[model samples]
Target chain A: MINLKHTKMKNELIKPQGLVKNANRRQFLRMGTMTVAGAGLLLIGCNNDDDMVPAMPGMVSLGTGDIGILNYAYALEQLEAAFYAEVIKGSYFANASAEEKTIMGDLEKHERAHREFFKAALGTNAIGALEVDFSSIDFSSRTSVLGAAKTFEDLGVAAYNGAGQFLESADLLLIAGKIVSVEARHAAAIRDLINPGSADFAGDDIIDSNGLERTLNFTQVLTAASTYVKTEIDFSQLPS
Target chain B: MNLIKLLDTICPDTKSAEDRDRFYSRRDAFRQFGDFGKKVALAAVPLSILNSIPHVAKADTASLIGVLNYALTLEHLEYRYYQMGLDSGVIEAPDRVIFQKIRDHELAHVRFLQEVIGNVLNGTPVAEPGFDFTAGGNFTPFSDYPTFLALSQAFEDTGVRAYKGQAANVKESDVVLTAALSIHSVEARHASMVRRLRTKKGLDTVKGWITNGSIGSLPAATTAIYAGEENLSHGGVNVANLTGIDAAAVSEGWDEPLDMNQVLGIASLFLAN
Candidate 1:
């Protein structure tokens, strides 16, 4: 197995850090732009023609139609991959039980695979690598790490579920189906690690009385993920 | 004009009782076209008749209903397995809650699919077929805890793949597609928990996500469940060597889909003929 610690250090050196360094200042600017963009969207909604607006700088559009949904999934996978990469390097995981270590380690790889799959499949059309800000998570504590993992995994499942209907391509939809279940498996494992043998694995919070998991719209999911991601996502083409 | 001959023409793989039941349903569907029904011999009804008839809308509806019925069939099998296992007293505490929760979810899935078929879609829901968890007396899941866990893993994993295979079939209906996706993830969660339980009980090779189709100590019957799961390619991309992680982890990262025929073949094992 590749040493995760060595890889983390290598990532820190080679991966782009310039964007993350200015995340705080850029986030403020992005928030202002988003408010204006939100108003602009409302006005555009009043019009019948749903033509694509030309690309805007300092902002990333998820694209239009099936490509839009694929980019949306790509964005989420990037966030998840980044989060797990950090989790494996944390002190808590470094000293965890064999079972916990195995779960966390495998999670990182699975998420990375998902991330790379989308990137490769999307090719030129794929969205750029996202910049995630997970400073809120305390990696030194097991509860904190697992709690955040639970949140990401649940959100990922819901996002994929909601986005499936938007994808016009059956092939792309099948690809999404392949990844979403793995995300759910990751979610359940993390939940069990927190409360072993408990009903929390498929807790009522996420699963409804009808035995279905929750589905979240693009807007809902993006809003929740905004706290962790520094990159401003413009999903105007994606339906709410 | 025998129904058996007509069914053979329609579905060549009608070798099981469940397959026969599917054909019987199709027979009823054909009878609904009253004008065409009276003129044509049942065996002479060509598959292309659907294109000639002005039933395109109805045809689409039938296909969607067909997909949902397939899903409900699997859910029925899982619900019965867990329900019987719980009643048999093979599942004890700690583990008991896991199976109980899984049982309730499967039941909910059954009810939800039934309501959608009957009320929302205005189609007849498929009836729950009889199940023999013993798989023709090959093993006793209800009496043996390890056997129960093994079967649970296989069923949950199969449920995940089965729903995935049908996603494209239901893609035309946004509501149905979304509902199916929601259920798909829950099945994965169940599969993961079951696998974890197996690991905790000394099946050390088992992991939440399948690794290289490794069945660990599970019976050979379940080898089919993990078949094709070792696939390392996705969307034309070879992912095995893409990530720095081991190839096994890469395979574990993505769950593969099993098409309708393959899923039915596996489900047929438990179907009470």
Candidate 2:
């Protein structure tokens, strides 16, 4: 009999090593303590700064079902758009080669469109603008900027891959399918820029032995994303 | 969370002793085929169980099988194209490795789908079809590096669009849906790499992403690969109307899907039969 586990992706690819470190840094607060601050707005209570509870004050809820998935995507796109927008303004972009500038400029616009598309789709149900912190990145350095861009783009691909299962609506799933490919394209371009003309564009780290890209679940995606985002998103309502 | 649900259980006593004997005999047949059969046989265990599920409707499994077969056909086309391209010594030393990587992926996709459809799902895998890379003598891909690169770009982009078109069909099975999405993104990655390579080679009109659905220096026959790619509206929102993002950005932001008929129309050009 064939080993069925071969059909499933390697566990490490689906749940990367960063997940464990991320889990430790940002703890998932339980539900029931959440409060609806206003019509269509859900908030989570702030932690008391105890070791067990991470200080998650006024976290926004992504709600449940398909809406929650859209909100989750919207939040991630916001982070990406903000990151690229920052990249374009940085000294690295201003002093970069013509090709590099074109790539960065196009990336900024694509991410902005992605963020705005989700915002329009969700309409009133959309989550508020997420505040991202790029303090850890050195915008003036090409290595730093491209490195961050690569991370966001790759993570976005994985996020969409894993989130597809949780979506109840096929239409929503198709929409995600459309966006994830664009993210993958961006990821490849960023990787190529970082290491010109190398196979690292589709390196083994992200694409598995089976030629399939990484697929991280909701919690895993948010944990990795939490590194750059300052907003405390209460993903409790989002499907696991 | 039952994330990788490739058929949870097989109802006991569903298969007769004769059926079990036939399965074992088939396993013996598979062992003779070497690595491909060995890998397929590994996944065969669970898929055989899936065939005997009592409560799950037969159509659900059948539809999934159909989708897998459809994907398998495309993978086969890409695999053979790259294989022949490599064998013909048309690719230069600098670009050989990238094409090799892509070829390996297409082969993996072919084998992966074959394992599920032929062994797991108990359905027949589609036979590899004859291909004419020249597309009825319209161009020479083997002797000409530029034509080879053009076809590579078209096939990769078409793969991305084809998979996206089938996303909704496979959404019923999370296992299949996730796998398909994983492949879809890789196609996109390959497409980006090829397009960028073309731009560096002096096809300045091309970028990693499609520019307003233009096929750049590629022949007009490949126009279908980029057809409908310049879609500005998605889910009822015209992205062009969004602030700070122009019409080009809106078109490139989200890729549009090509239905099965549209894909086959393009694929048929390369299909010898």
Two-chain complex of model 2, DockQ on C-alpha atoms against the true structure: 0.43
Cα lDDT of model 2 by residue, A1-240, tens digit: 111111111133233444554455444453323333322212212211122222245455566667778888999999999999999999999999999999999989988888888887776567788778899899999999999999999999999999998888777787888899999999999999988787877888987666778898666777778778767665654655
Candidate 1, pairs of clashing residues? none
Task: Report candidate 2's interface RMSD in Å.
Answer: 3.6
State the lDDT of candidate 2 residue by residue for B1-273, as single tens digits: 121245322112335676655544544443343334322333334544334323222577778778888899999999999999999999988998888989988987888788766655667789999998888898798999988998999999999999999999988777788889999999999999999998998955688888788888888888888988888877666779756578887788888898899998999999895
Worst 10 residues of 2 chain A by lDDT: A1-10
Off by over 4 Å in 1: A1-57, B1-57
| Chain B TM-scores across candidates | 0.78, 0.83
Q: State the lDDT of candidate 1 residue by residue for A1-240, as single tens digits.
A: 111111111124123444454335445555544322211111112221232333345456676676667778889989998998998888999999988998888888888888887776665566677778899999999999999999999999999988888877787788889889999998999899889889899999998877889888776788788888877676655653
Top-lDDT candidate index: 2
Candidate topping TM-score: 2
lDDT of 2 at A135: 93
